[model samples]
Target: MKVQLLVSKWCPVCPQAERIWTEAAQKVPMDLEVLDVAERNGREVVSRLRIKTVPAVVVDGTLKTVGVQPLGEVLKLLGA
Candidate 1:
């Protein structure tokens, strides 16, 4: 599964989300992709993914997480 984390530069929520995804990544068979919204292809990814919030987590091309989340919380979302 492809797990993409879309976050903004200096976003308060990004760090927490990152930790959760990082932990979940270890437990799940997923390719993790972290994208900073301020970088190249950032806008396009958000647009194609229909992301309206930061710290967004997309799994298998579907938006599954938004905003900040705890590691345990994220795991439940990923069914890990």
Candidate 2:
């Protein structure tokens, strides 16, 4: 599975999301990608995904969840 953790440089919750997903990635077998919403590619992705918030998770090209999700929820989303 492929997981994209979308974050914004100024968002307070972004770090939390990153940390949570980073830890989860160690236990899961999926590929994880971290995107900064402030950048061009990240902006394009956010726009394409129709995401209005930071700390979003995209699973296999589909936006799955938004906000800072717990590690368990993230792992569950990845079917780990």
Candidate 3:
């Protein structure tokens, strides 16, 4: 599976979501990519993903969830 976690530094939920993603990613046997919305071209990447909010999880090119989902749920969303 290919998982992308999209977030911005200013987003309150981003950090927590990042932690959750990191943990889940360690368990899932696939590629994990994190896109910081504050990075250059970050906005464009988010827009291409059709994501309207930070702390968004895009799994295998599909929007799974946004904001802070429970770690277990986040893992499930990633198909782990």
Candidate 4:
């Protein structure tokens, strides 16, 4: 699965989002990409997805969650 974790530099929720995804990567079979919304590609992806918030998770090109989610929920989303 393709998982994109979209975050912003100034977003307070980003760090935990990063940590959760990073740890989850070890337990799931997925292509995880962490994007900083301050960058070009990140901005493009976020705009294309119509996501207005940070700490967003995109799984298989579909927006999954827009904020910090429990690890169990994330795993379920990943189909792990």
Indicate which candidate wins on lDDT. 4
lDDT of 1 by residue, 1-80 (tens): 88889988779878878887888899877899998888876677898987888988888888886888877887787777
Mark the regions of model 1 whose C-alpha exceeds 4 Å error after superposition: none
> What ranking of all candidate models by TM-score puts the best one first?
4, 2, 1, 3
Give the TM-scores of the predictions, in the order they appear: 0.87, 0.93, 0.85, 0.94
Residue 43 displacement (Å), model 4: 0.8
Q: Model 2, poorest ten-residue lDDT window?
A: 71-80
What lDDT tens digits, residue by residue, belong to model 3 across residues 1-80? 88888888788878898888888878877687888877866676787876788888777778878889887887676566
Location of the lowest summed lDDT over 10 successive residues in candidate 1: 71-80
Instruction: Assess candidate 3 and give its TM-score to the true structure.
Output: 0.85
User: Which pairs clash in the backbone of model 4?
Assistant: none
**Candidate 2 structure quality by residue, lDDT tens digits, 1-80:** 88888998899989989999999989988789999989887898899989999889888889999998788887777777
Query: Which of the two candidates, 1 or 2, achieves a greater lDDT against the reference?
Result: 2
Residue 66 displacement (Å), model 4: 0.8
Per-residue lDDT of 1-80 in model 4, one digit per residue for the tens?
Answer: 88999998899989998999998999998899999999998998898999999899988889988999888988887877
- On lDDT, who's better, 1 or 3? 1
Worst 10 residues of 3 by lDDT: 38-47
What is the Cα-based TM-score of model 4? 0.94
Better lDDT candidate (1, 4):
4
